[model samples]
Target: MNELATKHAALASRFQALAEAVQDWDAPTPVAEWKARDIVGHLTTWLPEMAAGYGIDLPKVTGDDPVQVWREHSANVQALLEDDAVTNRVVQTSAGDQTIAQVLDNFYLADIFMHQWDLAKASGQSVGWNPEVATSIVEGMTPMRDMLAESGQFGTPVVLDESHSPEERLAALIGRDPAWTAG
Candidate 1:
């Protein structure tokens, strides 16, 4: 796979790892008061939202338990992923208008990169990402500057330090504090 596809695949791996790590994890943190389940729920919610931007009707959240909502939504997201139209086309949304390429570049790829860190901290698992993917996300997101400010409510501020690893620094620069520990 080329760099972009590789990055996407890597991010997909990280998201899967995050999902696995946090699946049984139960705790609360800054993103939401619920737990890691809620964080996954939120990501699951956005999956179809992105599909909607691509003109696909995805499952909607209408449940009390965030985990159940996420489970249903994840099923929809999985189905959408199987559909070429939803995955291959880009569409605009309340977050920001982006082409499919840009969405994959910025949101689908980068958002998940950062969210891995978020999920890691919230679940007490290592959220470390490969440097190449981190660098790619940072570079891609640079042009879409405002997207972070708009939909970044869930991300914690990434704290920078000269001694930090490239991935850690990249994470911090985007809003996640590498040193953060969920209480």
Candidate 2:
């Protein structure tokens, strides 16, 4: 697998493990309104949508099974990474057409990091987000935050802790409380 694919697989595995754990856990998590199920559902929903934005049409499921969606989307992402036609190609978006590399390097990483936190919050699990990956994702996404800000895709900016983990910084960068609570 290429670098992007490798990162994606690592992230997926982490999430899958968390999903499994949450299935058995009865303890309350901070994101009370959206338990572990919702976090998985969100990843299942958005990951593919993001992949689809890259010009690959993942398998469409009849209902809202985020797991199935994630699986399908992940396949597409993998395919896109391997395909020559898409490797250097640019997919059009509201932000404009970005290269596949850019999508993988910048957007995909950020999405995974944020969703990892989302999953952690819902599942009441701690994330082991790599500081290097987190830093790279933040650097890649920082330029576009201004554009996303006007569209309200990113949250209000706040002072951040430099020593914070990548997931925490990433969550704060996008305006989500890394320590968000349902209550």
Candidate 3:
């Protein structure tokens, strides 16, 4: 596996751990109206529609088993990243013609990195990510603050001190309270 594949696998592993640790699917998440299960649901739901644009068909998983749904979805996405034919194809996106690999790496992977914290906290499990990766994600998102807020997909960002950890900054920038904990 290459760098993108490796990153995807590592993020997926942490996500899977949180998914399996969900003692209550209905637990509230920092994402306003979402729950522990909705975190996985959000990821699984969006991926297929995005993959379809590249002529890739990802399986639609039911919510009956959120952990299994996440595992299967993650595996399928990883397989696509590993497949030369799939990853190499050029696809027309709003951003223009980008290889399927670029689309997956830039969007899907970033989404996973953001939501992992939500899932972990909601499930009453601690979570973290590579700081460099977290910083990179924050940098990419900073320029799109207006667009992100308008999309309603993200909440209004909170102000944080420079001394805050990158992960905390990430959570704050995404409208999540970094200090949030499960009840």
Candidate 4:
């Protein structure tokens, strides 16, 4: 498998694990306004629209079971990631035209990565994510911090003390407070 495919698979695994672990769909998340179900809903709502730009058809999620909805949509996305025709296809976005691979790397994968943390935090589940992945995402997105904040995609970054770890810093960079706990 290629790099993008590998990354997608990693995300899929995390999502699947979260699905199995979660017992409450309405559990609050660190995202403030979004609940556990809303996290899945957000992804289910976006996957099809993004895939459509690459001429890939994804099944619409219809059920109220957020886990099932995520499972179905994520499976479709994972299949598309494995297809060269889908991954290599160029698609137009607000940022201009980019290959599906590029979009996955720059947007979808990062979204999944961050949301995995959200899901875990909301569900009170622990996930041992690869440090390398977190570090890479942090390094890649740090330069765009101002733009992402301005775009309303992320909250204002939280100030971290020097004692914080890289992963904690990454979480803060993406507008998630490392100290956040689901109420």
Return the top candidate by lDDT: 3
- Pairing residues by index, what is the TM-score of model 1? 0.66
Q: In terms of TM-score, which candidate is strongest? A: 3
Residue range 1-183, candidate 3, lDDT tens digits: 877889889989988877887899999998878878888898999889877755788877775889998998899888878888878888888899998878888888888988988988888777767788778777778778788878887888764666988899889888888999877
Please write out the lDDT profile of model 1 over residues 29-109, one tens digit for every residue: 435465666666666677567666566687777665544554565555455555555456656655576546556555565
Model 1: residue 98 alpha-carbon error in angstroms: 5.4
TM-score of each: 0.66, 0.70, 0.92, 0.89
Judge candidate 3 at residue 26 and give its lDDT: 91
Q: Which ten residues in a row have the lowest lDDT in candidate 4?
A: 157-166
* TM-score quality measure for candidate 4: 0.89
Model 3 poorest 10 in a row by lDDT = 153-162
Q: Which lDDT values do the candidates have, in the order given?
A: 0.61, 0.63, 0.84, 0.80
Residue-level lDDT tens digits of model 2 in 1-183: 677767777776776666655543333444444555555555456655766765566554334555555556566666666665666787776658777767675656556667677666655577777778778767766776766577665566443667877777777777677777433
Compute the lDDT of residue 55 as modeled in candidate 3. Answer: 70
Question: Sorted on lDDT, highest at the top, how do the candidates line up?
Answer: 3, 4, 2, 1
Superposition error at 12 for model 4 (Å): 0.6
Candidate 3: regions farther than 4 A off = none
Query: Per-residue lDDT for 29-144 in model 4, tens only?
Result: 98889988898888888878867756778776868888778788888877878888878988887889888889888888878878888888888887566777777777777788
* Count of backbone collisions within predicted model 4: 0
